[model samples]
Target: MPRPRFWGEALRDDESGSAALEFIVGGVVLLVPIVYLIVTLGMIQSHALGVEAASRHVARAVSSAEGAEDADARAAAVLDSIVREYDLDADTLDVDVSCVGDSTACPAAGETLRVTVAASVPLPLVPPVLGLQDATRIGVESSSVQKVSRYWRDG
Candidate 1:
């Protein structure tokens, strides 16, 4: 007959499966934060890329347009398309258009058209309560400068 073990004897017995249990528990504790970090980084990087693309395309469209009205239309179109494609929040998006010349008018002939795009990306799992999401948001910005063609005209 097998001998019945006392509580002390049971405690002294070789621990089976303890390593697996510890590994599972430890892995879960470490893995959750690691995964969250990766997801948050991905979101920030996507927003950065989106802002960059928006600036570049907007500058290009403005510089290439034939007139001020055309330039406005082109910039708006490009910004809208990039915002949609990158899943960026238009409400938080800010765009600045300027000219690197003595004249304040943008996209002038022989001038540099500068387009700056900025946006905020909310962190993953951030709660909207108490404006925590807004407080925890990461800001991303990008600027692009394109030279306007010397032949550029306002028709």
Candidate 2:
């Protein structure tokens, strides 16, 4: 009889639901920003990878080409392809291609090709926290350099 009374009193004193509620609130508070940050970082990283790929594409084209004019066109085409493939707006990307250490009016050997791609990546869900109406913009810049191939010397 005494044990039963003690068990009933313990059950009445227990506050199990309180812990569940606290856990729920805490989980929500901690999980939301963590998820947002992860998504934002993923988006930024994806943009960075795209920029790097574009830079490498242009640099390789320039290194293998006989002149800057053709290389420039190839670079533009590569960039456009990347933008379309990644579903990124063309206006958001800024691409620049140039030859390094070229003193002549035309593309030359012993020179390096440089390509830089910059873009603004949108954050996933941070705008509401900052009281802004638009998504947060993150800037990504990638550059690549390629040494002129020896075969270009004959051209």
Candidate 3:
């Protein structure tokens, strides 16, 4: 013989599939932010790598160039190509080149050339409205140094 439950008692005790439902709801609530965090970190990391590569390559190009003009051209070309390849926002890109030597002029022969590339990476899915895009940006910068040839020439 089985005992029959009243409607109120049955409803109160009825938790058969509730675990799965609660699990689903709890998972969704926990997962959304985790996914967003992963996406944000991924974007920042990619931009950081891009900036680092840009600085390293630019320094190498400038150091290996034949002359001042050649160095400028090479640096510009490398920076531009990296920007495009990395999908970095050109408007946010800034490059600084300096020489570590007594010479006032940059890219002096036998000097170490330093190149810095910096950019602001916006968080993924940030809206453009109300300046949120600009407000939520993360700044990434990288610098690289390369020594010019001691016999390097200036034209």
Candidate 4:
């Protein structure tokens, strides 16, 4: 027969399985949140890339355009196409255009044109609302600049 042990002896014994069990439990406690964080960051990063690409395309489109009306039309089309391609929320996007000589005025030939796009990437877990007017969200923005043709004159 085995000798009887004291109250604390079982817990302190050289057990092979208990340590492994504890390690697994502790690892699970520590790893789950880390995994979730990684997933969230990856999702946000994809959306950020989409916004950056969209901004660059819009800037290039606007820079090559002739007049303010043409630029606006090109920008609208480019933004819509990009948003569809990236599967991003169109309502959450904000656009800003800046010209070298006059910030608000149309970009003349050879002028530096800048386009900025800002979007909110929704979190993994959040309450969905009918409209995002008041909802707090993660903000991501990208800016792109392009120079218009120096020699070509718009008629």
Candidate 5:
């Protein structure tokens, strides 16, 4: 008995589709992680930039000789400006500003002025893929030393 011609043709054709199938599977496997990494880094960069701006504003305000208490209002104004500049909702963000100045002021010269901002945002296809059902919450903190001008105090 001899094998049928149809059977031999069918086996040869089966091997033809195998390469196409492998390429599709490999593409899907490689694409997923690359996409995830790009998204994660982008999110982190945005948060960091916002924080850097906030910290600079707070530091400039606190460095003035008026007093640390006066800096509080200035800090709030700076934070509001950041929210507007970044197009982020005010309600979604929390800002905390701490200043250190003269003895009567914050009692620590050259000390840190810290600004912290936190926000919660939805991460599309990220949390779910990681088996998480909730949105991601990101927090950023930036600190700078107060720079008091001697000329201002002397005048």
Candidate 6:
């Protein structure tokens, strides 16, 4: 049999596998979430990029609309395209277009138009069931502005 050890020797002997165990447990508890956070943030950023593009396109579309009557319809169509392209839920996405400087009619000539796109992206590695109340969904929003052509006239 091995010689009996002092208290310090017993303590050192018990620690042989503890480091590896702690490393594994700590890695699972911490490293996994860190990785998931990075991936989820990346996904959220990508969705934000899509929203920004959609906002820019919608602003351009509204700024170029020939008449106020057709502008809303055209803007709706563009928003629909964004929803389809981004695979966003209709209920979770909202778009707003407005004109600056006291212009009631959006896209008024020589005015600046702004488009805001807000959307929710499901968190990466999260279960859909966990997002039932949208707690696991991240909101991504973007706004874009475009100036109407001074020489243009609304029909």
lDDT per model, in order? Answer: 0.91, 0.75, 0.90, 0.83, 0.62, 0.79
Cα error, residue 80 of model 1, in Å, equals: 1.4
Candidate 2, superposed: residue stretches over 4 Å from native: 1-13, 126-135, 149-155
lDDT at 108, model 5: 40
Candidate 6 per-residue lDDT, tens place, 15-89, comes to: 566788898999899998889889877878778877987899888877777667666777789878877886677
Backbone clashes under 3 angstroms, per model: 0, 0, 0, 0, 0, 0
TM-score of 4: 0.77
Q: How well is each residue in 1-155 modelled by candidate 5, as lDDT tens digits?
A: 98667977888778655788899999899999899878867866776677677767766775663554556677778888887786555676666655454344441455545555565544546546564634365555565555554423321
lDDT of 2 by residue, 59-137 (tens): 8887787665666677778878888776665778887766777456335677776778888887664456654524557
**Candidate maximizing lDDT:** 1
Give the C-alpha miss distance for residue 106 in model 2, angstroms.
5.1
TM-scores of the candidates are 0.88, 0.74, 0.88, 0.77, 0.60, 0.71
Off by over 4 Å in 3: 1-12
User: Model 6 — TM-score against the truth?
Assistant: 0.71
Query: Every model's Cα RMSD, please?
Result: 3.4, 4.6, 2.6, 3.7, 5.3, 3.8
Arrange candidates, best lDDT first.
1, 3, 4, 6, 2, 5
Models sorted by TM-score, best on top: 1, 3, 4, 2, 6, 5
Candidate 2: count the clashes: 0
List the lowest-lDDT window of 10 residues for candidate 5.
146-155
- Residue pairs of candidate 6 with colliding backbone atoms: none
Per-residue CA lDDT of candidate 4, range 2-107, in tens?
Answer: 8999979977775676878998999999999999889889878988998999999999988887676777799999999999988889998999988766644457
- Assess candidate 5 and give its TM-score to the true structure: 0.60
Alpha-carbon deviation at 104 in model 6, angstroms: 3.3
